[model samples]
Target: MTISPIAYDVQVHEYSIRVAGPDDLDSARAVMLDTVYRDFGTGYVPRWHGDIIDLHSAYVAPVRHALLVAVDERDEVVATGALDSRGPAHPPNPRWLAERYPSGETAQLRRIYVRSEHRRRGLARRMVAALLDFVAADGGYRCVYLHTDPAVPGAEDFWRSQGVAVCDEREESGQRVVHFEIPMPVTSSPVVVM
Candidate 1:
């Protein structure tokens, strides 16, 4: 499938988006760890000495995951998101999902982060739409699910704007988790150019 490159605002910095591979893992991990530290502040502990070595190792260990990165013209990683081919692990109690999802063929959208300086340029929304389009065109995923901390205020609304609906809510690991899901729309076959 040919996914067209999206146009950017003239005022925005020039950047490129691509599917990240092994070579980009170090930069990706640094972006992830730095964002985590910035968000968590002094409370950030050294998860593997707060280094990209171990973090990149763990991220690359997953088999069914896709990591995409957006880099500025200077080739510096600016934003990242990890898309998993499976939904959240089945809730310990199946009944917990009775009111919402009736199936498990969903993708997990995790670790979606954009640098503070790049937050309002529509980068996050573009990244998300690109990820969803990727999953939909791949033909197996039917939905995308994610959890966000509501204390951030705008997060819930941000996901909502992306067509994600809150399906459940709960607290875990000291954070208020708001579960959100977006049903994948049926996509037409891509035009084959041979």
Candidate 2:
């Protein structure tokens, strides 16, 4: 039997996702930490802690970036994701990417993490769909890309199932990194209801 995703304590059978508020930082942080420790063990803390501590500027407030959090039963953030503009202001790779994206915007999909307790319950799919819809609504994105570890068991399979194509896969530093991209569907004008 397929289990449905859980929401807040009041409605255990429902799950709600929304743009995060300042109050949700703690829960969001917990989910991120859980995901990192789950994947990298305890070794990434020192290397990534400083970056993690500064998530606010790029994800939280006073910035145009979009950060979404999914709330499960007990109102805990079971999943989280962010969209950082891959534009002139923040280019992930200026030398190569600038030539490729000369006229369109590319969004960098970041921090898509789902808690172990909520796995296989369709939360990941929903979260991705929501992020895509958000981008489509803004009418400013041509494609979205993300970097992930393909060797991590079901990671590649899951991303492939989401219609993501393997754009680049290479070894970086001491570890392997896989890059995937999905072209966004062009959004049409909204239907006007009389």
lDDT of 2 by residue, 159-188 (tens): 787765544435333445566676675674
Q: In model 1, what lDDT does residue 155 have?
A: 73
TM-score of every candidate relative to the true structure:
0.72, 0.75
The lDDT of each candidate is 0.62, 0.64
Clashing pairs in 1: none
**Residue 151, candidate 2: C-alpha displacement in angstroms:** 2.4
Show pairs that collide, candidate 2: 7-14, 7-72, 7-73
Q: Top TM-score: which candidate number?
A: 2
TM-score of candidate 2 against the unseen true structure: 0.75
Q: Worst lDDT window (10 residues) for model 1?
A: 3-12
